[model samples]
Target: MRIALGERASGGSARDQVYLALREAIISAELEPGRRLSENELAELLGVSRTPVREALVRLRDERLVAIVPQLGTFVTLISTEGVADAAFVREALECAAIRLAAQRAGEDALAELQANLAAQDRAQAAGDAEAFDGLDEALHRSLCELSGHEIAWDLSRRANGHLDRVRRLSLPEPGYLGEMVAEHRQVVAAVAAGDPDRAEEALRHHLRMVLSGLGHIRAAHPDFFEEPAD
Candidate 1:
């Protein structure tokens, strides 16, 4: 399948566009684990020049999504349980603080935006549209961070989700996974809306821990995709 840039393509740098497109595909499992990548093939598939495709591949490799071999072409890296757990820790800590700050701010506009996000999530869950739900899940959390006056924390949190991205994508197909997440998100938002710091913190903590809660079943179901757990 071909990669296409979003609205940012019109004004953004070509290399950046290529990077974002390829990264999204990799993260969303569109490319899948262990898929081989060649700059020439990718350029052809994406219908772009080899230079930008090559540049994008370099960045993806740096992100640990693509591994370069001396003789072999680039391959998608397997998911690391360690990576996911570490990221979850960072995300939980940061988000707990964010929700506390958001509670303090409790601006009407931010609360409205969060409520709107919940409404969209409800529709996605009813439709069982995991991809849509995942996108909105990300947006809702980032919105809380931004509203809490900690946009940089959100950026930092996103960088830590490389392996977690795969787990989230893998879990999306499970029955009621996203729907369960919708309810957790609603709890977090409800706390934010009510301006309750303690409740917001607790809800955000629970929401973040949901990633850990499903690790057992996911690893059992997709052993090939996961790295062996450390002793």
Candidate 2:
């Protein structure tokens, strides 16, 4: 079901609103992989016109979250293991470098922000709010990139990280995973706060490795959700 964008008096552009809503739905898995997205249905459901829905779908396609097939329709892109693995590798390298740079340059305020984000994640996890926790996870990583003063790298990392997020969410249903993730974040925070670049990088790498391992289990559990590797 689509969430309503408030009253018509706001004068907000429908295309932008539709774009944001569809992006969130796809990222949160509300729109399942390979599910067909009908422009007419979406426009009707969202109280917008087909023009805005079409624009939103095109943007989603650019983001690789939706695919347009000739003579068929747009479908939510399937999560591919190879895609996840490649994205994970890129994220790990960028994030590890980010953490190390953060350790070298982050001040007390920046460190505190990171700590607070992790605390919020913990609260979200305890409340059984995986979606909220996921948002905070993105914030924390992005904050690390910002701390490095690398806006270009941060922007690139953000896109790559979106791809990795699909695999990351797959692990949330596993038993005891939340607690383990909390501990992992704590260790990374501590390392950054200690101003130990090497240690921070190590911690970041460890966290990425853990995420990759979790993705392995997800792959095993839902083979159909992923694309087969090219022969």
Candidate 3:
């Protein structure tokens, strides 16, 4: 949402550009849940016409990142516990499978790269740079799928984990949470380096499930940002 539309989005597919910008803002909590949005306002913010903004809104609505109410307005969708659980399940499966293959095919070079990523994660944790830490998390996961020689799996995994991203972002505020995540990541990388597929898979599963396991605590602390499961 903070994109300077005139400067950045003037050349590319304006609708796709708008969509990515708004999606990043939503994921990063720049556009908080239940926040009101309007095509007119977004168009003005991005310095573009309303057409592309309207297109972008439609895509976001389909992703359930935004909700449209007739005669009311558009707003960011509140995090739903059920949706987070579902995304977490799919992400776990994909990542576990991917890590297994990575352990099989990974060479010394790939293992070394993962170690380098862990070193960066350590630095991010020490600096309290959650954004950098999260970025490194993605890099580490993507590196696993990349080593599997199935780049498309990483893309699919990313798309499937969309809902979980919101939950993960919320957990970043918890005390010592990021450091705990870094430790789990280190364990996974060490297992992969050992060439032990079963160990690697278990470690990856545990690492990825942290978001789901911590969901309750986050929901308790930020009740207004989430909708409870239907009885």
Flag the better candidate by lDDT, 1 or 2: 1
Maximum-TM-score candidate: 1
Model 2 lowest lDDT segment of ten: 2-11
Residue pairs with clashing backbones, model 3: none
lDDT of 2 by residue, 1-231 (tens): 754553321356778788877776776577878889898888887888899889988887876778999999899988876767777788888888787888899898988898889889889889988767777877787888888888666677656655567777777767888788888888988988999999999988998788777776887886766677679
Ranking by lDDT: 3, 1, 2
Clash count in backbone of candidate 3: 0
Clashes of each: 0, 0, 0
Q: How accurate is candidate 1 locally (lDDT)?
A: 0.83
**Residue 74, candidate 1: alpha-carbon lDDT:** 87
Where model 1 places Cα greater than 4 Å from the true spot, the runs are 6-11
Q: Provide TM-scores for the models.
A: 0.92, 0.87, 0.90
lDDT of 1 by residue, 1-231 (tens): 656675424457889888888888788777777888878878887678999988888887876888989888789887788878888988888878887998889788778888999999999989988878888988998898987888988988877777887788888889988778988998988888888999999988887888788988988998878777779
Kindly list the per-residue Cα lDDT of model 3 for residues 1-231, writing each as its tens digit. 464543323467878789877876777778889999988888898877999888888888877788989999899999877778878888888888888888888998898899999999999889999888888888899999999888888888877665789889878867999889989988998888888999999998888888888888888888888986798
Ranking by TM-score: 1, 3, 2
